[model samples]
Target: MSADQRKSPTEPQRGNRPPAHGRRRILITGASSGLGAQLARIWADDGRDLALCARRLPELERLRDELLDRHPHSVVHVYQLDVSDAEATERVVERAVVDLGGLDRVVAGAGIGMGARVGSGHADVNRRVLTTNVIGTWNTAEAAIRHFWDRQDGHLVIISSMAALRGFGGAMAAYSTSKAAIATLGESLRSSLARRPITVSTIFPGNIDTAINAGNPDKKWSVPLEVGTAQLAAAIEAEPASAYVPRRPWAYVAPIMRVAPLSVVRRLVG
Candidate 1:
């Protein structure tokens, strides 16, 4: 298929969808912690059935237990899948769709970040970070899109970052570029899916205090995970194709970067 063409769903829709009043079924990757975990909690409170995936089995199990305890009637299934592994990711995503009876929404929350000076030849770090943040997110979104196409009524949320708004500086070369790729990928998917019954939401979040940033000592640069996740959740509910989380000073950064000369950004970021 052409890059602009929308791909149809791969499987037949299964089970009877609940009444309009019933909760949405959502599958979220990287659900073991941070914004992913927060999204799971907020959605479960609304009675949504959940299929959560992450590499951390213990954390995923904990989230599953918590969700079940909070919403006794809701079904929360946890899968140990790393989105970077294409075959394994596809298999587990297929299972999540079947077990959840089909998905009404998907949040591709799996990603990684790294910063240690690009030319310093942090080869291993750069490679691993790109694999996790870019390709891993791609894998998750591709799987989710297939399921959404079959259901013909669902939203795909792609979690990018404010760093994506502009190519960052200092040691963040690889990390910023990877996130920018995800943001652009989501934007393209949004256009392709517009004619279809499916919706694509691209979220650009600012400095969320997730484990992804745990290595960074600059705590002042980060905001509470809730601040970012809450904004993202609201955008998901609105079903917008693109959003800038927190929607304030952070949102302003994107336009500034877009309009400002690259030299200015380089000076500031450097």
Candidate 2:
């Protein structure tokens, strides 16, 4: 079967019905740049309606103008949102659903990648990472779930990381932990709503050449922004329960990390 033809764990039985087609209404967070922006573009190319939000309104507006220019028929709405604020997240989600008419899928993609070594006087960095990655994801998921449950059908796409596969030391510790928590959150929702039409997909992405990580000297095994986001968009359309983008190495690497020695894992991260 084609990649998009594959069914997710929470997808209804094959004979029951097929996946939805035509213009999809999608809401994406952290869409100012990086993977989030690319995903929006991919969907827009398919003439999909989108509600995009990020802390940066100008960036979102630029994206909106670009999308409108490219796909005139597509409806694109931009909102300024900081997913870390639970109340704001909920309000924005509700408004987006209204503005877009309805939401078929919601992508939790807003996240930060700050470095702070353990026991280093920089506990603030760790706290910020946790708040933005974990709590922010939860806030987005909570809002999406309530709306999806009411409609009895929707897809929730959580952007996790390959770092979630194993624990890391030093600066990566908190970030790794946050990714793991969100992955678990997606899985838990997937299990709970298995019998329902609501689908939850957790995506574990490897190093992608986004603006956030552009300066990192270690570009080892990293895919370009376009390639990574294209794969992500395909996976989201497929609605897989969980996936590793540019799956080649990471799909195989994830399991190895789970069983590898602590020293080996440390070296791998370093």
Q: Find the candidate with the highest lDDT and give its number.
A: 2
lDDT of 2 by residue, 57-174 (tens): 9899889778766655456788899999999999999988777777889999999887689899999989999999999999999999999999988999999998898887777889
Task: Return the TM-score for candidate 2, rounded to 2 decimals.
Answer: 0.89
Q: Which ten residues in a row have the lowest lDDT in candidate 1?
A: 1-10
**Winning model by TM-score:** 2
In model 2, how many backbone clashes occur?
Answer: 0
lDDT for 160 in candidate 1 is 85
Compared with the true structure, model 1 gives a TM-score of: 0.85
Candidate 1 residues lying further than 4 Å off, grouped into runs, are: 1-23, 214-222, 261-270
